[model samples]
Target: MNSLEKQVESAWKNVDQQKDTLISEHSHHLQNSVDEELRTLLQSVRQLLDDDGQQLEKDVDKLQLIAQQFREGVEMWQQKAQSSVKAIEEKQRVLSLLVEDVSVRTEGRRESLIQRQQQRVADTEDNCFRVLQGISS
Candidate 1:
């Protein structure tokens, strides 16, 4: 080949090499962009999962606290009920003693009244007998 043909062939080869290099670089850049976008999306998903997990933990803690409070309330109410029952039993015992005392006093009063009535009847009978004897004599 002549010198001009050689130069022309060399120029064409150079142009072809530049075209191939540009296409390869563009493909690499597009792949990098897609990879970066996928990475960003994955990071967002991870953040959301972390937030949800934290919220779930907080909710579990709140539920546990409420359960503890409920248990305490039930125990306190049971104690109150026991104390109330004890108070009522004491009152019942006191009332029983009062009733017994009242019954004894009433029985004593009835006996004394009966004795007085008998003595009065005897005195009236003696007076009547004396008056009848005097009249006869």
Candidate 2:
């Protein structure tokens, strides 16, 4: 039981560590990308007055579309992560119930076996007593 507890604790720590690593990596990547894009956008804005106004408006619209898609992708990732957590929790709950049931059944069987062993010992003692009495007579 102690070993099992240790294993579970280790597993939980691993999960937490992995989650933190992923979040940090994801944020770092996004931040670098955003910095690059912002620099590019700033350069474009500086030249906007020299370019055709209609073309500038179209480019802005395109950028808006790309931003919307990025947001959708991030939302989808969040939903998937949440669903995975729920599924793992449900599996853990069911497994715990199964282990508890097995433990209870094993306990009942152990008590039954102990009673049978005790009865056998009592019977052997009675036979020994009778034999000793006959010898004395």
Candidate 3:
């Protein structure tokens, strides 16, 4: 009976050791899985950051194109404005010349009209004197 009891104790100790070994292996496997998940999360974050950088670069390129277009448009507008200003200055010069010419012509016409009125008055006086002389005769 003593030998049978010793055999049973030995068997129980072996079973306990197996159980401890299995628990330790399970804990190691769980830690490895957690490490793998953390690594995957870090990689995804890095990829996201890289993608953001690429998108920002593209945006900057688009803004540069827009700025170039705006500059060209402004340059064109300035050219057109300068041309319009030149045209307006020429028109003003022509208008001033026309006004001067018309003023000179108008003054000449007024002087001619005054000279014709003085001649008409002299002819009327001469006719009146002739009538008076014929009556005296």
Question: Which candidate achieves the best TM-score against the true structure?
Answer: 2
RMSD vs true structure, all candidates: 45.7, 4.1, 45.2
Query: What does the lDDT read for residue 57 in candidate 1?
Result: 60
Residue-by-residue lDDT tens digits, candidate 1, 19-127: 5576567656755765575567556655665668877666556655665675566557656755775576567557755766786789899999999999999999999
lDDT of 1: 0.68
Please, what are the lDDT tens digits per residue for candidate 2 over residues 28-56? 68757865885687568657936767777
How many backbone clashes are present in model 3? 0
User: What RMSD value applies to candidate 3?
Assistant: 45.2
Candidate 1's C-alpha runs over 4 A off are: 1-51
Instruction: List model 3 lDDT by residue over 1-137, tens digit each.
Output: 34544565575567558755765576567557655765675566556656688676665566556656755675576567557755765675577557667867898999988899888889988998899999998
Poorest 10 consecutive residues by lDDT, candidate 3: 1-10
Computed on alpha carbons, the lDDT of every model, listed in order, comes to 0.68, 0.76, 0.66
Model 3 has an lDDT value of 0.66
The TM-score-based order of candidates, best leading, equals 2, 1, 3
Name the candidate, 2 or 3, with the larger lDDT value.
2
Q: Pick the candidate with the highest lDDT.
A: 2
Model 2 poorest 10 in a row by lDDT? 1-10
